[model samples]
Target: MNDTVKRKLNIALRINWFCYVGLLLLFVVRNLLLEGGSIQLWVIQTVPLLLVLPGLIKQRYRSYLWLCFILLLYITTSVVGVMMPTRGWEDGVMVALSLILFFSAMMSSRWHRMQ
Candidate 1:
């Protein structure tokens, strides 16, 4: 296989393991540790939705773009976290940040193949 194809495959494999596997574990942790079966859990679940959004789009996503997206979300979450004390909205934001972090780490490839 060409280097480009091989690189893409490797990255995709890594993404599957890291994001899916790690996120699943975190979901369990949130349920076990935090307010289980409550709104908190619900918020945590929505996090994955944002993480997977880039995949649904037609354009090929590079690691830099992914990182930028995650960082933007992270920054938004952090700001919201500090400003909003209420557990209702902010907790969801926190979950979102966690999701971004995990997803970014997972999807990131050593060599990004942009199309």
Candidate 2:
């Protein structure tokens, strides 16, 4: 890839990681702090991302593509949460952040494959 694309991909990759990790942490912390949630519940919230983290850390295009698929699940969940009567601003924030992660992951993977 050209320098510009490479830089863009790197930036996107970083943003994807930030959003994914931040959301994961937020889920865990929010549940534990607010609800005294169980570790099992936290694991359930986090295990999906654990499956993809290694590949993502390695900057694999295939991983990025798969992550886009994974992000769809989160996006759907966030939208549903936002629509629910009990949902908060946090749910809306998650929806926005996940969309950013999805876009960044898609673009990063596409750019990586193009190179």
Candidate 3:
């Protein structure tokens, strides 16, 4: 890839990382505040994301692809949360972050292979 494509890939990767971390934090905080700090809930929500961490840190295209799939689960749950009568802003934020993460990861992986 040329410099511009490389630059774009880096930006997408950075956005992917940022959104990934944001979703992680959101899950942690949401569990703590709404689930009485339930360890089980935290583990269930975060373990999949954590599983991809090693590959993600290595900037592996396969990891990014897997992340896109993993994020779909989050988006589904967040959409349900949004539809609930007692939903809060966090649900909306979660949906936004997950979507951003999914797209960025997808694009990052595509760009990675272009090199």
Candidate 4:
């Protein structure tokens, strides 16, 4: 509602848009240079995630809840994989990324709300 919140929200939205565009560009490169349907799927999955960015920027409670759910799922998957015999390093990376997103959403929302 305040100027600080507006500024933070704008920044969050800008960052989110940059990421979304980057992802799509990667997918395009993969499709053009390489050749993979999987890359296409990744790009498609990216859209919904990008779509949620606006809500997060607005400091919507539901967006925060969604972020919490995502973090929980990331944690659960990483833990399960670590406990498993055939664990992969990327699973840990997933956990890290999830934490980053979660913290970013919370901090950004808080920063936006403070103003």
Candidate 5:
């Protein structure tokens, strides 16, 4: 890859990581505050994401691809949360973060393949 592509790839990867971690933290805190610290909820929400962590850390293109697929579940739920009568700001944040994560992961995977 050229320098520009390399730089863009790095930026995309960083954004991917940021959104990934942010979503994870959001779920954890939301569970703690709203769900009374439900362990089952945390595991259900986080384990799939955690499963792809090693691939993400290794900059594997397939991992980014898988992350995008996993993010769809979150996106769907967050959208539903946003539409609910009792929604909070966190629900909006979750939608935004998951969307960003999805696009950035797609970009990262594409760039990684090019490299």
Candidate 6:
């Protein structure tokens, strides 16, 4: 990639990383605080994300692909949450953050590979 495009890709990757973290935080808050779930339960629920975090921090395209699949699950969960009566807004936040992460990762992968 050219200098400018590589820079842009880096920016996108950073956004993707931050959004991923944000979504994870949302999950923790929703499950542990809002729903009164136990820490062990929350850790079990979010463990898969931890597997991908290192690769994502290293800006690996493979991790982005894996994250896309994970984000789909999150999207579905958010949609179901939105359908619920009380938790709709929280789910909406998840939906938006997941989408942002999804697009950022997707674009970063594409552009980075074009190098």
Steric clashes per prediction: 0, 0, 0, 0, 0, 0
Give per-residue CA lDDT, model 2, range 1-115, as digits (tens): 5999889887887898789888887787767776656888778878887888899888789998898898899899999999999997678888988899899989988998988
Clashing pairs in 2: none
Judging by TM-score, tell me the better candidate of 3 and 5: 5
Q: How well does candidate 4 score on lDDT at residue 69?
A: 59
- Model 6 poorest ten-residue lDDT run: 36-45
RMSD of 5: 1.1
Best by TM-score: 5
Model 6 over residues 1-115: C-alpha lDDT tens digits?
5898889897997798688778778778877887566888678758877888888877778888888888888788788878888775677898899888888888887886788
Selected candidate, larger lDDT, 1 vs 5? 5
Q: If the candidates were sorted by their TM-score against the true structure, best first, what order would they fall in?
A: 5, 3, 2, 6, 4, 1
lDDT of predicted model 1: 0.52
Inter-residue clash pairs, candidate 5? none
Question: Which model is ahead, 5 or 6, in terms of lDDT?
Answer: 5
C-alpha lDDT of residue 82 in model 6: 84
**Ranking of predictions according to lDDT:** 5, 3, 2, 6, 4, 1
Worst 10 residues of 2 by lDDT: 28-37
Q: Give the alpha carbon lDDT tens digit for every residue of 26-78 in model 4.
A: 44554455544376666564555565667766658567557555556546755
TM-score of candidate 2 against the unseen true structure: 0.90
**Tens-place lDDT digits, model 3, residues 34-91:** 7555878889999999999999999899999999889889999999999999988899
| Reference-based TM-score of each model | 0.39, 0.90, 0.94, 0.50, 0.95, 0.85
